[model samples]
Target: MNKTTVPSAPYTRRPPSPPQLPYPIFLNQPRRAGSRAEFVLTPSYDNVDPGQLTAEDLAIITQNQPQLVAPNVSGDWRYEQRREAQRILEFLYIGPHAVIRDHDFLRREGITMIVVARDSRLANRSMASVDRAGGTLGVRCQYIDVEGPRDLIHGFPQTIRDINDHLLSVYRGQMQEMDKNDRLLRKSDPPVRGKVLVTCESGNELAPAIVAAYIMSVFGKDMQSALQFVGLQRFCACFDENTKRLLQSWQDILRARASVARARTPVPGRPVPEAKPKRRLDQLRDHNDDEMGLGECTMDRERFLGRDAFVPFVDITNDNAS
Candidate 1:
């Protein structure tokens, strides 16, 4: 017989709780009457801070500003000529209705192609004017009509590409004609000697954007530089926010495409070997170095510098012997 008794659980004492703060805690106290009065009496520009202008105010200001008037170069047509590159025989002549109205000027300037960048209605009207002028001038008209400025902005990249392709074809045809005439092709000279006319409703915004796009695509200039170049040629070549954003978007697309193309192209050299996995510390150090992005040392002794690398030695032995 075993007398087994369960031992009673030992009593455990809990630690004492921290003291609580008084119930009513005031986060923000009222300002003094004097301070409040001073704030109320303070004078401000419409109670609006200098850096606190709303978007609506900016828009209103922009709207209220007087629109710049481009110089009337050719009647009501609003024309201006721009030459991008000096060596290139062709120049970009931009204007409004005056381009189609004046046939003699087109022929005299040797404008072989007329690009109409406007709505269908305006384009058709201009085309009709060109028709009335007659085909005797031998100036070919091309209509590239989008809905409005926004539509033109969105579709600008493709539109410029198409126009450039057409121009290239025209230049190629001229080269073939030159070849047929048994002319010696000079590498230094432009293949085509024809000029191009780019026009829209008004040669202010849309036309300049198109010309800037052309310069960006053909000459590999960035959007800002192209815009600046075009602006220099045309006084009224100002772009709105939407148009500028579209151009920037198009430029980014072009750069991405170029990078992809370059990546796809095979390099004419041995393939690089895959690097071995580095230690954790090495990887961390490498990552820090990459983040710093320091340029390569130009003063490296192994680097080639034709004359700078060559150290001149004086003939001291001959002088000592003498």
Candidate 2:
């Protein structure tokens, strides 16, 4: 019931596209010589309950929040996970960039969401019911069940990276196929694009969300871009491994939904891999300060003396304390 407030610091805004630098940067470059592109990346794991988002948290999210839609609920805190899922759907539907909110309706447009439930039977049953209900009203909703090992829920980021990497590979192959055909795709292949949303029954695990966010940060530009990188990971009804396989079988359906309507060839040049960035901590020494006080440090290392020699961060509070 306790609420968490958004950090007081302002969110950083990013430029439209990856910045162009003097030198060419590789995909896995240690430090992207240039800026990254803006994209969403919000992947949560099984145990985290969405309904628990406090008012302060919501206030921070409202700045650029999208329309969310999920199942309606009463005061039952236990069902908050499902309720929050419904809220996200509502935001997605009414959100400015959203064209489709339902997972099944994604086929009409080039969009996709990969949702892995802990309980596949329940996931499928829920999805089927939604689809059937939508049909009665003339709204078509077709959803695919995503299956994966239960261990994947614990290894959320790695799993998400695997999926994203796989998606990228698939897109690359599709572009190559178009290139072979010498169609419009051969001339200009667009990047393979899609989104993922992984969930579980309890809404407790957050590993997947952390991993997804880290991946997006490595590739995406800003926080919203990271948010857009993925969707809410709902912890809903439980599921089993068998149900998981049934869900995985639907990858083709997701691929179909995400496929490009028109073929567009990618740039002729090959993309290079990025190098890993060196963490500042790696360069610091672990020796106690007292041991090195006598200036027995390495020649390459410089020593700091008075305030005149030490440059504090611009935001450091109480400058006189320095």
Candidate 3:
């Protein structure tokens, strides 16, 4: 027994294995209300290891969690290239960004006016760009600021009217200047004398509604037709159902106003009679004029020639007298 005890291993206990962690150690931890922490402890028994998740998988899982998502920024941040209308010449443009972002493109396209369909704050920013560009571009930039969607709907009729009036006034001023300078006018019917960019935060709903309303106002198209025409120009142009109804209501109002205007407007090619009672010719005549000279020449012929001077007369004996 003493011989066999030569190399008996010293009595030793194997080191204890690390304790296995619960599938997700934080599963039972309480989450704070409204916490924006990205990681959420979700328990699963499918034998999938948390360490096995790829970055993309983790990202997708995190994205699925509502608390960690970010809010959307305004549409102004999503700038895009200026798009011209297909039905109209570059007279009208639609865009998501401010005109200042595309100053060069505007200069190249001869955009003289910028109709910014945004709130005051956003419009002010765009207006600053317009002012900066105006100094170098040698052109005046006009801006139109429309209130947000609700206000726009409430004031749609007046808003569109005001915009049309501004456009007409600017275009007329340009035409007058051109005429004064003896410049050749652009030959397009519904002349593209003024280039206006109608824009909103995203150039999505409000801008399109305004543009469509403009089309309906200027081009005499129905709301549906106007929207379709705008859609043709910019495929993304659209309006919600409420906006469509507002537009339709506006169209009705416009039609009513137009009818009233036509009724009030005197017919062309015929002069309107004066509303005041007419005065007699004698009452209108100036009595002092008769004293000066009434239907008679006032020249003094006697002073030019003596009273005895005789005028030459044709005679039958002229042939013999010569």
Top of the candidates by lDDT? 1
lDDT (C-alpha, whole model) for all candidates? 0.53, 0.34, 0.52
Number of the candidate with higher lDDT, 2 or 3: 3
lDDT head-to-head 1 vs 3, winner: 1
Q: For each candidate in turn, give its C-alpha RMSD to the true structure in angstroms.
A: 29.1, 19.6, 43.0
TM-score of each: 0.51, 0.27, 0.47
Kindly report which residue pairs in candidate 1 clash with one another: 77-98
lDDT for model 3, please.
Answer: 0.52
Models sorted by TM-score, best on top: 1, 3, 2
Q: In lDDT terms, how accurate is model 1?
A: 0.53
| Candidate 2 TM-score, C-alpha based | 0.27
Error of 3 at 30 (Å): 61
Per-residue lDDT over 81-197 for candidate 3, one digit per residue giving the tens place of the 0 to 100 score = 234322222356676645456667777777665555667555546455656767876555555565556557565555555554545554545343355568846445444454666
Writing each residue's lDDT as its tens digit, candidate 2 over 126-216 gives 5543444345433333232334443343444345445445344444444534354565252234444433333333323332333233333
TM-score: which candidate is best? 1
